[model samples]
Target chain A: MQLAHHSRAGGSVLVWTMLVMVILSLLAVEVLRAVSGRFQVGVQAATWQEALLGAESGVDLAVVELRKSLYPAPNGAWQDWTTVPGNGVLSHGLTTVPNAGLAGSPMNIEVNVDAPAQLKDPATGWQYYRIRTLGSLPLSGPPRVSYNKEDNRLRKLTLLNQRFIDGLFTSETNDAHAARRIEAIIRPLGSFDQAIMSVGVLDLNNQNIVIDSYDSRDPLKSTNALYPYNDRNADGTLKRQENGNIATNGSILDAGGAHVYGDVSTNSGTATGVANVTGEQRTDFYQDPIPIGAPTWTSINPAPSTVTNNTTLTASATKGAASSRYVLRAIDLSGPQTLTLAGNANGSQTYIEIYVTGDISLTGNAQLTVAPGVSATIYFKGDVDIAGNGLVNTNNQPGDLLFYGIQPDTGQNPYVKLGGNGAITAAVYAPGHDVTVNGGGSDGHVFGSAVGKTVTMTGVTNLHYDEALSSGGLINNYKIVSWFEDTR
Target chain B: MKLQLKKSGGFALSEVMVSTAVFSAVSMGLLMGFTSLERNFTATADFATNHADEMRISDYLALDLRRALSVQAAQNDTTILIPAYYDNAGNPQTPALDGRGGVVYGAIGSSVRVRYYLSGSTIYRQQDSAAPITVAMNVKDFVFNVTDLGKVVTTRITFNPTFMAGGASAAATAATAFYNTTLLRNSRTDIASSVY
Candidate 1:
């Protein structure tokens, strides 16, 4: 009986020991697996971040291709980009990073650009585009370690059963790839890129000349989007904003004490009195060529209207209506001849293109008034002399009144002269003419932009450039207005 | 009956010695296994802690560099200076014009300056006149390469080991440096202007 009991006890001890050993071994395996899993999670987080950066690179590539279209090209080629048949979008096929020849890029990026959408100012034909991009990095490939000494990249962490390269970490067994999708909107930047652009010498030759800017689209900058600005400070005081810029291709000289509330730049030309410029004063600047050409008139129905002294000449056109044209003869106003330009009587936004064949010589207090709701562009072929009360813009919208000097095929010298006390709210575009802005004490406000071959300003002419015009001109450059990621 | 009892006592003595030896061997094996597991767990925890610290610093610096208006050399103990262009909730401080056409741009670019500095192994961040607070610890070296003209800022950090017993960690580093480059946003072109 004693022998039997001893053998039974011994057998029980052996069985219990085996069971405990098995349980302990399982726990060890589970702990190691948990540790490996934690390491893998860290790798995934880093790889996803890298994928996002690649997606942004795709967007930048799309912007470069779109900008190329701005220049004259064959069929507006976007560098071999194909069109999406359904949406007409230009798609850049999936391409590996680092271009070709460069090694160690394990990512791919693709770009797409949609067709242009016309802007509000249909006359300019300005447009914006939508761009989409896709960036992805596959982790299913064999894991790689070791830094590329040739590329001078930092050495990756020697992870256990993992891979890390170029700031991206991944597991050797990871089969799924991460992707990032981004969409951005590219739009034409503001029109009047600057307050003034001169092809020749721009002389601010007077001390009392003031250069400032104000935005008419903002109610705080202008009263009801007009003049008599709304006090943006809520302090019941009108202040000039420091964005009234000026630039010239030739020398900018003799700016004697003229407080330019904006920037001044020139291409290999000196700018005098830079101390007076509140904004940046720079040289060696570059600008696009300003070409002021007359538009080809359609000569459609509703014959061109003629303006007479003491009469209201009406210029009318509705949305989607055929553009209208007007004829104004070059005549010297001998007395107090007042010509009123009125919009459509039906309360429609009307725009007209006027053709002036002769010189406009205003003497004494002879004034040409621009009524409300009228947008006019006077294409003059001769010299303009506004010596009287100047162009009286009752609407006070600078963009509403534009003077386009047409390059005459063969004619007399081209010049535009403004010498009156009345505040002129108009943009003058004559790249080949000598623009002279004289007279006007503190009450003389020239609220517009000027692009002349040579602009000479004197007296106390307060050139209050309309900041809103910056949004008007043709698309000078491209800008990303809005960008976001598509999480889906 | 006397002979059988004597034989039983002698056999019990031998069995006790053998059983004690076996129990001791098993206990020692188990103890060794547990000690090794504890060491590995500690080594992994140290490595993870170090990696997390490095990631945190890289992410935080990238964010700060992207939003900074300017990156100047630490003057009088200040390492970096960022403007208050964003509020506490990460929303832009928009400057609005009043109904009277006047704009008070205090909200757009405020006078509040977010500053950073390093003291020994700790990095402290202070906003304007506020007291400095510790942002990071155990830093061996921190360097900033600022290209003002390019509007780019590159930051590199060197960290000390959390546990020196891991035989050179796979993730954390003491000799190798981790760096990040960030392009700035909302830069004031007038202050430090660059031409393309």
Candidate 2:
């Protein structure tokens, strides 16, 4: 009986131990399968992320291509952007960097400018482009596909698996297994297109101030009573409506008599005893104060090799039409100063840009002249003072000569004081300080815009706004208005 | 009666039965654990796939709506009108003005006219009569609601998706909803229109 009982207990222990071992083994197998599945999925997720990065790389390349299109030669010669074939799509393939344990994928990009979706400026006829880009990475092929297709029956068995894999990566019908689309609206910065733009109080205290516009491109185009400022057609007929629009962030106080030929927009203040305003006197027009920041000064042609600091020129200084730029730290014209910019006789227009750091004082009949078809712009980083009959003389259109006051000198209370007895026909954009036009006896007839903080017209000054300047004759940088991703 | 019956040689009937019962109970517990793990895995995988699909569709809709000029939704489909212009190099062709001084914006460009709707279990996007692109599949339900707030337009999207896990026998589902408000960039209010 003892032998039988011992045998029974041993048999029971063996059966229980076998059962427990079998269960544990099966559980371990299941756990291994789950872990393997998770590893595979994780690898796929990493590939997806890498593909996205590749797509973004394509966008970066597109931005560079766009900049090239805007200024093709890089020497400031204008080129037609719309002339590029296939809407500016470049045939290029990008392979990502294989560094830091990452074997990047090969990406392809295609760019399309939605011409019909472009935005056009009504007054200037300048169009903004909407660029669409498609970035893609090819799909990975299944392993041992040839073996699976060796037999027709086996191929049939693998069809469903192949379909599943394709569905996982494919987007639309394109060859790109992983792909993304991006649409961006790029608009040029028309920051200085208006006739007058100011950031301070404006005062029109002159009685004989006449503000109007005329097209200087044509010598015969003039402002008259019946035509106002409209351009005449070839048959001497009015083409369309033209007006010289003026605006001020501050007040426009006409203390005495004044005649404004175009619309007068003031953010604040009242017009007192104004003789005539052709356009609407909009009091509700509000404009934010323009900030006076340092100039970007990007790739200005004929870049100065060295900066001119604290230089006073009393004799005549001549500059060639080709590659002429003056980057000065400080400049003063003492007496009888004449600066001349010669024309390029090869029918190529000459362009000149001047940058000043400190105060620019023009005293005792200082003059600046340029030939026809020559464009010149002076950028001042400090106060500008024209004390005695200083003039900027140019026979070209009013848009040819531009005075841009970008920054204010410290403690100088940077102001534009035009206290002379000569007419200056140029556009002045000073949004940091007040402008004082103190002259009389047919002296202060400004052909272009006079934008200042507080424009106190204490003399007989007339401001004329050229409608042609509002056209696409000015240069503006491209800006991205909106950017987003499309994952369709 | 000197016969000491050699103690019963094997286990008693009750002892055998009890051992068998305990073994059966432990096996059953292990089987239940495996089933629980599979169910949880299926649920997690389903949620991940659904979330990814929702994100893709959401991004596409937001970009389109923000650039659209006007949007109108109906029971069957939603139509979006996008104003388009062509740039002729630096010299853009002047837009024609009507008698009322309104700019006569002509036909929209290719791929600009978009319509989104649901057919069967798939969401289809039709662009200028192109082959309908399947934006999303296995969609159990979808809804689009548009609200116009003067200059701003808001669009609400809802998606309920169901996908097959393991095989046709095992089906998993996820539901999500979101609202995206877009301020129409180009309102089509130009100087000519306002003046007229």
Candidate 3:
């Protein structure tokens, strides 16, 4: 009985052991499957990320192309990018990552742009345009239709057309993860016609401030409406216009006795000094603010300057005298300084663009000059402090002497200050900050138009709006206003 | 002669009890191991899924915000409204502008009046009056902190993943946050003055 019992117990033990082994094996399999699934998910996540980055890169390339196509000529001729191929598509070569991750895959970029359409306001002649960009991963093999010999010719052709369009938006996988679509609306930054435009509050403290207009583009015009309000042009010529003055988005507080010779418009805030404004003073005229984009430093000749903090740039200094384009980090010119353009014999004007990365001080006699048909532009990334007889005199047209200021939100208020006895002849676009003309007891004047956060006149300063600036050829760059991604 | 042959058929009662007890203990241990492993595995999978969803949501918002002419966050930072246009093949669609220069989106575009919001635990995206799409799921919170820097706008998104797995509360769950500062690609004067 004992022997039989021992044998039976041994058999039962073996059976139980086998069952345990089987259970362990099944558990192991489940663990392996779970691990494999997790790895696959990780892989998919990485691919989706790559796809998104690829799409963004495609957009960046398109923007570069747009910049190249739209930059105006040296003679101030507009090269509208929207005119390219009318409703056609432009393709950038495929980009592939040649590493183990996402091996042998290429991302293609197709940019399609529609023709420009006129805005509702016909007088401005501003055209609005739209651009669409498709970023996709292309299929690795030829069409499946080609493998079937019995396919009809029409069917093959139809398949080819479908594949072609699909290639622009669809990826190799039917899954939408491999593709992205973005669309943008674009418009140009036209000329600034008003003598002064303030997006913020404007306080006029001077009584003798005279604002007027003249058409510099038309040489046959009657009398000069330039500075001194004396009916004499900057070149001693006679020209005049009854319209063109100040406009503001905020309130215009004219302390008693201030006078504006032309129209005054405030889109938002109240214009309190009714007695100060002469010609048609209209309130609540909604005006669109000018938009600005960061300037591309690519292809700019002469390396960026290494000048550091609080450095002075005199006419005699090495940095300021260079006739070539100079990118200054930060500069100060408190005394008399004249920037002259060289090599001007064949009417091939001197071309120079100065970019200031920090604060700029133009106190006392600060002047900028270019011979006939020559042009110069000053781009400021920070504040511009002009005070105490500081003058930016340019012989070229107001449009030729351009001042483009991009405000930096570094706690300091970015602005173009016109202190007492200071003056400038340039089209100013500091769309991000304020432009102040103050304390210029009798001689402060701004020849061109100002488009910025605010325009405040607290002195006997005058604004001379050049009617010729209304022409569309003055090239201000375009910026994206609205961007949307196609979720589908 | 009497002690010659006695046949015992099976195991003694105590021996049987010991074997059964041993088998039960081993089986329970195996089950426990598997259960622990599965819990960890499930947690990992849920985390990954949540991460991917966060990324997708962030990508969509970033892309749209980067090119947005105007971005307005409303309803206590729970909703965002954007007015934009995109070119569909050769057709150009844009949002209608209100008399106050605000975008009255939905004039004629995919989403002239696009809005993103959070309701309960799901993030939803809608265009005009169109039905909302689930932007992300398994979400505990969706919030936007928008800051306007003159020409450029920056937005921060906070996404939290809850610990609900298989209809049961998970012991561990972490929230994901994303910060993006998109310079307005399109220049729209109205964008600067828009109030959210």
lDDT of each: 0.61, 0.53, 0.55
Q: Highest DockQ among the candidates is held by which one?
A: 3
Q: Which tens-of-lDDT digit does each residue in A1-488 have in candidate 1?
A: 98999999999999999998988888878777666555554554456566667778877777666555544334254656665312344565455765321124377777766744322234344555666676666543334432212111111222242231322211222345555565565656543656777878888875567788887776666667655432554786574577787888776644566889888888878888666788877686665543445555566324334444565656666522344565666645647887667786654677766677767777787877777778876778789888857588866788888887776555556899987785778888777688888657667778888877788886756788887776664444566544444432
Instruction: Report the lDDT of model 2 for residue A327.
Output: 64
DockQ of each: 0.05, 0.09, 0.14
Give the TM-score of each candidate: 0.56, 0.45, 0.48
* Cα lDDT of model 3 by residue, B48-133, tens digit: 66565555566556655654555675531333445534344424354433322123234533235557777787767676687976
Best by lDDT: 1
Q: Mark the regions of model 3 whose C-alpha exceeds 4 Å error after superposition.
A: A1-45, A69-101, A117-129, A138-177, A189-443, A449-473, B1-28, B56-77, B84-111, B115-123, B136-196
Clashes counted in candidate 2 amount to 5
Q: lDDT of candidate 3 vs native?
A: 0.55
Question: Candidate 1 on B1-196: residue-level lDDT in tens?
Answer: 9998788667576888999899999989989988877776776665555455555555555545544555553422334444443456644343332222112123533434556666786656676777875555555344323334445666665554544554446455545456677665434333544222
Instruction: State in Å the error of residue A319, model 3.
Output: 37
Query: Chain A of candidate 3: what's the TM-score?
Result: 0.53
lDDT of 2 by residue, A1-488 (tens): 88998999999999999998998798688666655554433333344445445545544554455445443144222133323423233233333344311244455454545433235555445555555555544444322222111121211122123222323222223342445555555554433445565565556665577666665544455543222345666788653333555666666645355676667676667756555767777665555533444545554433333232222221112332233556666556657765555556553556666777676777776655655556767778778887665655555356677777764655656787766665665667676667776654575566666667666667656666665554433343444444444432
Evaluating just chain A, the predictions reach TM-scores of 0.64, 0.53, 0.53
True contacts kept of each: 0.00, 0.02, 0.29
